[model samples]
Target: MVPFGRLLDALSEVPDPRRAEGKRYPLAPLLLFTVLALLSGATSYRHIICFLEQRRIVLNALFGCTLKRAPSLNTLRTVLQMLDRDALEEAFRQHARDLLPPAEPGRMPVVALDGKTLKGSFDHLNDQKAAQALSAFASAAAILLAHTEIDVKSNEIPAAQQMIAELGLSGVLFTADALHCQKNL
Candidate 1:
């Protein structure tokens, strides 16, 4: 596959889940479009398809393709469902790294550790809890630098510490809610 730009180049590293003969849209662009739509408040596959359809013209220009129409909701859903989770996460991490600004000599990065439970993640039939995640956000760049799932959503301190240790972060200011200020944490 041909590289588009920094973001696309990084994203394109992930192998497409769909077979070559069955693909209608390139994986990188499709993933990027989904990310864009989600960031823009698209809450479902239907909303993502709508977001793409409404922006088809601009998307053609942005991706350097002549798409007659956006993909269907089924297409988007299937592609997403079959994607390799680890590969997608690595691609997103690369994209996030590209979006971050270079460190200034005297400035410390402000990272906010925020937790959220994914919508529609609860499974009553299986007695499962909602999926939760703690993300480290770059306050200045407004980008996600890293994240980890909170196995137990009630306490994010462990997840936050894990993310910080995994990133090997230093000289950084961290922020979070009062739940993170417990004596044991």
Candidate 2:
């Protein structure tokens, strides 16, 4: 199973004690949609719904969902939009840790940090660029940790430092491209 899938499973296991239920979709179905979205390169909620409709049976079986009904695009959009992004990130990180092999004491992990652009999806109304900074997979036991958006008028050094600081790479070796080789970076 993929780390993201395992993370979703772990997250689904957490009981919601709140008496006020917001939505009604089963955890398995939601997870199935998430996995399908990732696999099909669907970056938006609408795309995920379309992907789910096409692979209904396979997804249902993969996620162990017993739902007699299929979720609408609006339903999925509302549910996903309301979810706490921080909680989702934490779940993904925890599952990533679980999937990683045990690190040897003397052998430090090599983390390659870099940034990227999303190519599209920029909100034109807000005048925001569509650059999505991401941590690319470099090697086993290591990750390209964080990224910062770079615009025409702004520099990324400070943002990169902030990201690196949050990563807490005490024993690990960090490497980046020439853009990240600044004196303070």
Candidate with best TM-score: 1
Local accuracy of candidate 1 as per-residue lDDT tens digits, 34-83 = 87788789999999999989997897787776667888888888989998
TM-score, model 1 to reference? 0.76
Count of clashing residue pairs in every prediction: 0, 0
TM-score of each: 0.76, 0.69
The most accurate candidate by lDDT is: 1
Ten consecutive residues with minimal summed lDDT in candidate 1?
1-10
Off by over 4 Å in 1: 1-5, 66-68, 117-126, 153-155, 168-170, 176-185
Backbone clashes in model 1, listed as residue pairs: none
Estimate the lDDT of model 1: 0.81
Which parts of model 2 have CA positions greater than 4 angstroms off?
A: 2-5, 13-21, 27-29, 41-47, 54-60, 104-106, 121-138, 141-154
